[model samples]
Target: MKLIKTEDAVGHVLCHDMTQIIKGVTKDAIFRKGHVVTEADIPVLLSIGKDHLYVWEKEEGMIHENDGAEILCSICKGDHIERGNVKEGKIDLFAECDGLFKVNIELLNKINYLGEMMIATRNGNFPVKRGDKLAGTRIIPLIIEEEKMENAKAIVGDEKILEVKPFIHKKVGIVTTGNEVFYGRIEDQFTPVILNKLKEYSTELVEHVILNDDHEKITEAIVNLINKGADFVICTGGMSVDPDDKTPLAIKNTGAEIITYGAPVLPGAMFLLSYFNGDIPVVGLPGCVMYSKRTIFDLMLPRLMAGERITYEEISKLGHGGLCLSCDICTFPNCGFGKGM
Candidate 1:
């Protein structure tokens, strides 16, 4: 590329998009890249403070900004991810279906650390609806060495840098354990919360049972649901360490592999997760999930529905952004309640 005075650039092509900003009115590119500058266009270009401009001049080893952005988009494009057109040396990506979005943070960091380009996205490991914006790729300059983009591709190797796994339909069962709720002293409010959350996903409530804090009964209920072809089972209440809290013991008696009994997150420290026969998930939700607008359950539900296994290592990382601010107007899933750096 070469810089020339705007007046003598009548026949030259613009190397980059020229943006004209008018506060909230508009902030769009008035002169797009590769547009041949005409005599009539000089005055308007000058009005936007374009005294001089860099005109496109093809070089053998260098690539244009838009081309670099295309490479970045290619790295991020995966199943259920849609790519947008290059605009102002950037490309935006969107979700093609409702699913859990994931980022290959290791490769992403290596590419970012190489400099000259960037891929910005919403927090991963969360639910994203169809047409939701997933990521945007931007090149820092109007031109860069083609080798740099090639290096990024090499770093990413055979795998895409990001992914969106569509949520799988799940057959669910609920075990509501608590003496008060079982005896009808208090309403079964916890079941309503679970049901309401279920409305967000593709889930069928195949089984539901209300019982006192009995380990044997809770264990029997969980196994029965699994035998009935439940994709997963949720046990609510009786998760604390109190003497009467037998839910944890019941889950153990069922012989399900317990991934973790507690998480390092607020409002969800007593949560438990296990898998029966190595596949069907069984979870014990703390009482906080019944009342809190967002908790560990909300953070992990999308992944669970998508059939992603949650390891103890993954749960241990939630401490960074697990504290919900409980804002007056809570915009959950959009907020950083479970997105750790």
Candidate 2:
């Protein structure tokens, strides 16, 4: 790119977008990139205090901001994503479908570390709806060394750095294990809570079994649901350490590999997670999930629906941002709960 005086820039191509800002009215592009400077445009350019303007003048071994931005976009664009129109040497990526957003942190960091460019994105492993902004990319300067962007592409390799994994539509089975609710001595509130959460994803509760605090009955209910082709199973209540809390033992008896019996998150610390037949997941939720606005269950449910595997290490890492403040009008996920995981 080359800098030319606005007075002598008639017929030169604009290399960048120039903004016109009016205190209370507008802040928008007045001159767009690639606009050939006309004789009449000189007055407007001068009015905007453009004594000199960067004009497109290609130099060997260097890339213009627009091209550099495109390179950055290519590095991160993945499945179920749409790229917006390039404006001011920046491009925004949006989700084409409701899914889980993922970012390759190592590659992202390496691209940013290349300097003279930036790619900002939302936290990965979270739910995003169609048309949600996934990321934005731009080059810092009007021109950048071509070699730098190529190096970033090499680091990104053949695969893109960002992806949106579609949430799987699955049939869910809910088992409420509590003596009071099983015998109709008390109303069942846990079922509704679990049902409401399940609605957020494309999952249907195919079967619900209410069993008294009996490990054998709970185990039987889980096995029945699995046999009936339930993709996910949840057993609420009786997950605590009390002698009567038998949900953990029931899940164990099903021969499911227990991913975790407990988590470090508040309001759901006594949570239980296990996989049945090495595929379907069975979750034992604590009572707090029925009343608390958000819990560990809320944090990991999206990952599960997206078919992402959960490990003990991943659950342990949630402790850093696991404490929920329980705001009066909770805006979880938007808030800082379960961050950096």
Highest-scoring model, TM-score? 2
lDDT for each candidate structure: 0.90, 0.89
Kindly report which residue pairs in candidate 2 clash with one another.
none
Off by over 4 Å in 2: 1-29, 32-56
Off by over 4 Å in 1: 2-13, 16-30, 33-54
Against the true structure, what is each candidate's TM-score?
0.87, 0.89
Cα displacement (Å) at residue 134, model 1 = 1.2
- Tens-place lDDT per residue, model 2, 84-107, is 987666999999999999998888
Tens digit of lDDT per residue, candidate 1, span 1-341?
Answer: 79999998987779878999988899899988866789999998998899999998768988877778899899878898998888767999999999999988888888889899998888888888899998888998777899999999999878998889999999999999999999999999999999999999999988899999989999999999888989899999999999999999999999999999999898799999998888888999999999988888988788899998889998988899878888999987677788783
Worst 10 residues of 2 by lDDT: 58-67
Question: Which lDDT value does model 1 have at 173?
Answer: 94
